[model samples]
Target: MTDAAAPTPSNVVFVGAVATASVLLSAALACATPFAALAALSVIALPRPQALLAVGTAWLLNQIVGFGLLGYPADVVTLGWGLAIGGAALLAVPAADMAGRQAPVARTLAGLLGAFAAYEAALALAALALPGSAGAYAPAVVVRLFLINLATLAAALALRALAETLVHRHARAA
Candidate 1:
């Protein structure tokens, strides 16, 4: 959160708003990998417990939609993928805080790269640790993820700006 956003009470209003925002944004921009953005949004808008709640819920919902409704295959890699996305989102807090202290573009880029890297690293570790992986990190998969990361982060940044603007506007109106 911002420097001025001291830890507020865990009231329902803001928490609900954050949850709704996360769900809507994640669904609307599913292709852009909104998990990272949701995590950063949590750090920016909510406190620690609430951040976890927001990101955790968003991640769960994403999984439900991705595998349940979208017909994604169930497999070991899919399980690992869930953990990776959640990890990326949860790990985005520090990056978001660091980026919050910088200019807008820097902030977004830092959040994007930093959070995605965390995901990539975690996934790599999972692959290394998993029984069937055999240490084979596919080059094509990496390339695809790199592209997804770039696009997702850009969309996330745009979403961040829109959310920040809305927050400011609401504050001003009050």
Candidate 2:
């Protein structure tokens, strides 16, 4: 049997849109792609398996855009950092899912914060093992990253809401 349940059409669309957006974001922001925001949104809006798929798609697309389009160094250290980011993104999914379950009223915000914390923590741990990585963890850098994630999450939510409203209006018209 397959490990994941069949994805709904909306889930497929969500994953595709998020992954595409992530690739574009990575092209612009490189290492500062808002993975925590994507992960949190996925977990908050989808089932566990679909959430994993969404986050994984975003991470994979970011890596492709980074290495293929953006010309990231094809070195061991760079590859290690990519893997670390993927791992952190994956970790954020579960953290956000758990927080969303616990706080229904503020599920989205709680999930976003939880996912960001987990993602940063995982990256910090990875930095300890990778030379020259600790500099990225400086307070100023972390704050900037957090702001990026927060803004991305807010924008994603707004876009999703707008999309839903448009779809509903179209359905009514039809």
True-structure RMSD, every candidate: 5.2, 1.9
Supply candidate 2's per-residue lDDT for 55.
90
On lDDT, the candidate that comes out on top is 2
C-alpha TM-score for every candidate: 0.60, 0.93
The residue pairs in collision within model 1 are: none
Tens-digit lDDT string for candidate 2 (3-31): 35677788788888888889888988999
Tens-digit lDDT string for candidate 1 (1-174): 574445565434555655675556556655345555555556555666666776677777777767766666789877776776677666665655556667656765676666656656665676665554543357775666566556655565576579779989999999
lDDT of 1: 0.62
Each candidate's number of clashing pairs is: 0, 0
